[model samples]
Target: MNKNFTLFNVLPLVIGWIGIKYGINWLTIIATTVIVSRSIMSLILSAKLHSSLSHLSETVRSRYRAVLRNPQLTFSVAIINMISLALWGQEESLIILAIATGAYFSVRHQLLRKT
Candidate 1:
């Protein structure tokens, strides 16, 4: 199994535990898990992409690099999570939004810095 994948699955259990301890609803817990998991995965993949760029053809490398640099996927996921939280009447939606935005920028910065 991929180390990143294993890490992705395992790290969220901590979030789940925190949620349970705090008595947070399942939906919010799930959303938090998704956001955290995606953020970690994106960063891991970005690092891997940076390391492997030399092995890829020019065209493929450029395209992959561009995709990694884009923040649209992160933004979309944040928007979806925000909308879902709002619809569910969760007050912590804003907190989630902040976290998602932070993650998005952090990942973008990492990719930009590496490349």
Candidate 2:
């Protein structure tokens, strides 16, 4: 229905896919569920935004593209996820919170700029 909703749906699916590749135990399952749910939401929420993929800086674009093209980013995100998960059981919560914060900032800066 909206871009943010779309992003919310897509972000988790992408994140979950990464988690599945690099995740361990129950986390992998959680990631898979998130992936499926996000994918559905993303598809339902499609809008008129540019390809999220097209906005990357040249260097980042190349690197991330390479990572996405391969399974490396999944491993990397997995590692980070593992570490975050290890951090006193607060990892997932914090990461989600951080993601939400980032999303808020992005929406403000890009879609809702104050002039």
Candidate 3:
């Protein structure tokens, strides 16, 4: 996996580890859920819209990139991840979290318009 993506995936875990070490009730779990969920959403959106990405369409990629920058979008994804993690149990939660985290970094690499 890409180093950046791996870092993104581990972001929440790192925070959680820190909290665990310090004995704090940090929202790292919640944060992880959000980050992962947002990534899944962006990926789904990109796949739906990137019908011709094989040819390299900057426009579609740009739109998805904008989605990445949206706090609201990220928040929603995080919320969904949290709820899903709560109900689906640990394994599913971990998988989704991983996807979300990995995708978080992928978004930067896949930025459409390029900043």
Candidate 4:
């Protein structure tokens, strides 16, 4: 079997197993996984960048940190998830959307304050 093909199949297989075992919706599981993974990757990349730029001024470093922590991707994913859930008649979508939006604004506010 091709390695790429095997890797692709593994995700769905694991997702399916998790959904079945936990009795959770597949879409919810996928969205949660993507969101968490994105966050972790962002944090790791930001930390690496911060360390590499240790000689930079605090203002510059802080701004870069804020930019890296921006929640645009997370907000986009949450919006899509909200729409999907709403279309499926799930009431929890509103709460998820609200949280994502709130986080985005909160971070933006802090960034603006720093600037």
> Model 1: per-residue lDDT, tens digit, 61-90?
556558657667546645655555455455
The residue pairs found clashing in candidate 3 are 34-78, 36-100
Q: Candidate 3 deviates by what RMSD?
A: 10.1
Q: Show model 2 residue runs off by greater than 4 Å.
A: 1-23, 47-115
Alpha carbon lDDT at 68, candidate 3: 61
Tens-digit lDDT track of model 4 for 1-115? 4564344334434553566567777655574455444444445554554355536677876765566475565456456545544544455535644554555455445444543
Q: What alpha-carbon RMSD in Å does predicted model 4 have with respect to the real structure?
A: 8.9
Residue 52, candidate 1: Cα error in Å is: 1.5
Distance from true position, residue 71, model 2, in Å?
20
Can you give the TM-score per candidate against the true fold?
0.41, 0.24, 0.36, 0.39
> Backbone clashes in each candidate structure, one number apiece?
0, 1, 2, 0
In candidate 4, the residue pairs with backbone N, CA or C atoms under 3 Å apart (3 or more residues apart, or in different chains) clash, namely none
lDDT at 104, model 2: 33
Quote the positional error of residue 36 for candidate 1 in Å.
0.6
Question: lDDT by residue for model 3 over 10-38, one digit each (tens)?
Answer: 56555555655676654555544655565
**What is the lDDT for 9 in model 3?**
44
lDDT of each: 0.56, 0.44, 0.54, 0.52
Window of ten residues with lowest summed lDDT in model 1: 5-14
Model 3 TM-score, 2 decimals: 0.36
Which stretches of candidate 3 lie above 4 Å from their native place? 1-11, 54-90, 97-115
Each candidate's root-mean-square deviation in Å?
A: 8.1, 14.2, 10.1, 8.9
